[model samples]
Target: MQGFKKAFAEQLRLALPSQEVTLERPKDYQKGDLAFPCFKASQSLGMSPQSLASLLASKIKIKDATIEATGPYVNLRLLESVRSRETLASTLGNYPLPPQEKKNATILVEYSSPNIAKLFTIGHVRSTMLGHALANIYAQEGYEVVRLNHLGDWGTQFGTLLAAYELWAKDSNPELEKNFPWAAEYSSESTTPLHRLLQLYIRFHAEEEKNVSLREDARAWFKKLENQDPDARRLWKKFRDLSLIEFNRIYERLGVTFDSLEYGEAFYEDQIPGVLNALDSKGLLKEGENGSKVVDLSEEGFDIPCLIQKGDGTSIYASRDLAAALFRKSKWNYERCLYVAGSEQNFHFQQVFAILSKIDPWFKNKQTHVPFGLIKLPEGKMSTRKGNVIFLEDVLNEARDRIQKIISAKNPELSNQAATSEMLGTGAVIFINAFNDRNTSITFDWNKVLAFEGDTGPYVQYAHARICSIFRRAGGSWSQWAEPRSEDFGRLHFESIELPKSLQGLDHASAQHLIFELNGLEPALKASAISLSPTSLARQLLTISKAFSVFYNDSPILNVEQSEAIRQSRLLLCLATARVINQGLRWLGIFAPTEM
Candidate 1:
């Protein structure tokens, strides 16, 4: 469908010269397959839309394409053999390979950024899954994609934690000792123990509220740390190392990897100075209360001012982001930069882009935010502060356990292939999240995500596996079923095949449907990459699977009449369909198993 649209669009450009023609699918399959409205061209050609369509219908002849006029629209139908063969060749021959032109574009994708000392929640899954999928999609398109884990490693929260640790170390608490063994013993006889850490943190914040001096003290400590206080640096490195060890385990289970690990803290020394200089040069910086520097964007309708430097002159998030962007641009010279973040920070990105635009207009349009919706639990919204969030590792493990049980019941013989089961289980989790449009709120439903049937990831994997089973039963290699040359196989007689005509009806209809759908891949990818919507690719995979189902049930490969040409032709088509499904699933970072 995509190829036909491109060809038709080009043909129209030549035919009308002065007007633009848009290709669309007819609402009803019975009204031909692809539709083109002639309304715009009518005025330019000095004729009614209907009349213009009629004129073009008479003059234009696309090889292997049937054209008809319906009211003000021109509908087209491709010769069955052409549609089948092209779809087959593209699927089987070109998949998993990038076009020569798109091979060099380098992309930096930052996602799944969970804060240190926080449990991996469903909210974290959105960016992680979405980023991984986008990276895969870009890589498939031949881009040298750099996956960066821009971890939230630096913040005032660490100071609070440190203070909490100090207070807790003064008192010996056994429960805290058990939970946080590493930080249990830090003080002398008056030392606070680990169990009372949370209470200590709360007390510290409460006192800071009433006593301005204590607040100033904490700020002073942070500044000292920022100014290369040896103790602060040592603690920061230890905390960062501990947090990453835990984070990497979750990432490994999710089958995600990053080309680099850059901490938010890493940019503090160099980034703060550069950003301050840039803001000062632009005259965008303004002093706020408590010695903090802020960028006032109230005129831009954002009530929240971006705090570049906090009170006591400590750098904040906005400053770090600005530094990161400048560093990335100068280091990689990326044509496009994407930030996969939660939608709650939509305004934050708007401010970031606006600030960058003021500083470097060239980067204004190039920087993009792919914001996704929050992941809510059944009870309500997840809160990391309350320690009420489901860990990502827990989700993956539960999925794997459930899959293992199902495998035990259905295919016990293959239980030894633990690696494959792990892949399928993890794939399901990714697909469940990726299947939806990224901006919509996702209610994590265990039943829906883990389902082995229906439109889930495992379902598609099963479908591919089923096809492979057919190839095995046939006792021959798929290559034995060569694609029929145009001369050898003339126009297909849909009725001549063993299956009922209605069976082919779906594929016949869907071949056109898929062609149109597949045609949107490039545009869809560009949109997804820009918008950070893995859901688009998810939807694409679903459509491909749906098309394959139609092809599978309607077309018979093994039991058809024993004519060598027809059998081979059908096999080639089936192989091509399978290839498309495999490649599409891969883009979503899901695996297509060879057997269920």
Candidate 2:
């Protein structure tokens, strides 16, 4: 299909000298397979579109290909033999191999940034999975992508944590002596321990609420930490170290890796000054009530002002974000920068981008915010503080366990339990999320997620495995016969082959339909990248798989009384279908197992 589109596009370039023609699938398959609007061509030639289309229809002659005019649309029907050869070749060829001219574009994808002293929540999984998939897609497109796990390693939350740690220091269990072990233990502890810490934080806030002097003290402590005060700095490092240990374990389980690690706190010390200067230089900084510095985006309809600096001269989230953006732009020099964050933070990113654009207009178009919807629990929204969130690790383990049970039931003799567990478990979870619309809230349902049938990842993997089984049954090297070809094999006949009535004829009509569908891959991939919607690609894979399924059920490669040439051709088609499925699945971070 892609080849046909390219061929048509080149043909149009030569035929329509003064007008641009777009090759597109016809609105209805009956109107001919592919269509080119002749409105522009007609205008260029000072004739009616229908007349111009009719003229071109007579000139273009393709083998077994038909051309027709439908009003202003010039429709082309692909030869069945040509499509069969093309689809077979595409299925056999290594698709989406590294492009020759690899773009030296650096992209910093900041995602899965779970906070320190926090467990991995389902919401965290959404960002982690989505970001990793996007990174994979970008890499396939030949971009140098840097996956950054921007851990929430620093914040005022640490101040509260420090206060909590000090108060609960003595009650620490030796078994829980590891860093941030208290995070988990604290969840089960009496409210006494956490309540005390919360009270201290609240007390500090209340004291500073009216007394500017007390607020200055908290700022002084935070500044001391930023300035590398021994005690404050040591405590901050301990929290960061402990949190990373937990985060890395989760990342490994999820099969995600980062090229760089940047602390939100690290930016605070040095990046804040630069950001403040840039804001001041642009004359965008404004003094707000209560002695805070802010960016007023009221004109942009964002009701809440972005707090750049706190009342006590302390930098805030907006300040760190501005610094991070500048530092990233300078270091990576990325052609594109995508921020994979929750949709709830839409305003926050808008402010960040607005501030960056004000500082450097060149960066205005490069920065993008890839927002995704939330993952809610059956009861309600999950909250980390409430300890009501499902840990991503727990979800993964549960998925593995479910797959193990199914494997035990279906194939008790299977060895390599670990490998099978990983494949089924990870594949199931990824497919569940990837198949859904990115903007819709996903309710974590075990039954739906673990189902082996329907539009799940396992179903696709099963289809690939089924093809492998067929090859195994053939008892010959499938790879040896599979090769790319430009011309169609003449042996294949749609009328003789018994296929599903829906996909019966492999004549011009069916071939054209298949060709048009195949042409959508590249554009679909681009759309998936732009929208961060894996479902688009998922749907395409499903379509291809279903088409192949019909072909497999109807066409008999081994038993048919045909020449070696025809058998090899059909085998090559099967191989190409398998390759496309594997490549597409890989993009979604889903594995395609050779066997079920």
Candidate 3:
């Protein structure tokens, strides 16, 4: 397909020597496989679009394609035989897909920065998955990706948790038994540590409403923690350790990893002083309301000043972020650093980037804030302070449980049911999260997320599995047949596929459509990477799956009555489709099961 596209582009260039040529696909596939709009060329050539299109159509000639003028567009359609040959060669050949050249660059992707001692809630899913997918996408396109967690370990929230723990949870006290009875029951369990910490956090906020002094107490505890008070440091470290233990379990299930887990907000505590000194030296630091140290953004068109430190002399998130950015730049020298976070913090990032621009003007272009919308339950938005949140682990577990039941009933004899069900379940969750544009808010629904049909993860996974089943029934594995040139592989080889006469009906149409759809994978990957959105790639996978499904129903790859050449050709097509679905799913951090 790449060769075909390049050849056509070259022909169009030769045809319209005076005009720059760029080809695009028509909105309607029936119009053509590729199109060139003549509006710009017509204007430049002092002719009407229709006249230019018709004139160019007459001049351009392709070896295995037809060129014609449709209204103001010059359209070209490759013959079915040409389409199949080129597409299969591209998809199955040694150098396949992701036609993007080597970037020779590094991308630093920071995501899944769940606060230390907080639950990995569904609210965190959008950033976590979006960042993970972006990292995978960048890596696939040949960028050195550095995955960062950027844990939220140093904040007033931690102060509140510390105060609550000291007040009622550090020991078996009457307050703990009276206020949170279930905490004692779960105290001895391995998972109870983080859960109990969450309860303490929630209790602090709930109690603060009745006790005004609790807020001040929390601030004081945070101040102590900043000053490296031994007790405060010990408690914070204990809570941070427990929270990470719980988080890693979920990350394992989700199949996400980071290059550096040691770098959190707290890790930059010592560097904050240097950041403040630099700001002060540059006259960017100012005394704001309540004696807080700030950077006035009045000239930057921002009404609100960026707070660098609190009135109590403790550093704030902005200051820590400044330090983190500097540390990242000094350490990784990344070509681009992407911060994947929620939309609510758009202003915060703007201010941070603005301040960085003043300090290191070159950095403004290197950093990007990839903001995404929040995930909401049917009732309303989730809140960690109110304990009105759904944990990510719970959602994943529920998906696994529900999918397992369906698999149990549908395929009773299926081996590896447990692993397969888990894969399908998690893949379902991940796919739905990525199915839409990153900035669009999603209302989580059980039915939609777990759906097995119609543009869903399971639908695509099933397509791959069905193809694998075809090879199984043919007494060979897909890996053996799909890549027969491997040293030990021998089943299918690159050969001319003469379709049986019967395939010329609906089967032929669907087969050509499938081949064309597969050709779009490279373009889709490029679009997804450009927009930093996984939605484009997700839609492409679904499109490819649907096309394959039509071909699967319309054609039979193993019918004994058919010629072996026809069967082999169809099987080769199926192999290409399966490989694509497998790679696409894996890139999006979803598993492509050989059996489902």
Cα distance off (Å), candidate 2, residue 91: 4.8
Q: Evaluate model 2: give its TM-score.
A: 0.81
Tens digit per residue, CA lDDT, model 2, 380-467: 8876544456666666777788878887888787667667677778787887777888788888777776777777777777777777
- lDDT at 217, model 2: 56
Candidate 1 lDDT score at position 385: 47
* 136 Cα displacement, candidate 3 (Å): 1.0
Ranking by lDDT: 3, 1, 2
lDDT of each: 0.67, 0.67, 0.82
Models 1 onward score TM values of: 0.83, 0.81, 0.93
- Global fold similarity of model 3 (TM-score): 0.93
Residue 135, candidate 3: alpha-carbon lDDT: 90
| Best-fitting candidate, scored by lDDT | 3
Candidate 1 is scored at a TM of 0.83
How much is 156 displaced in model 2, in angstroms?
1.3
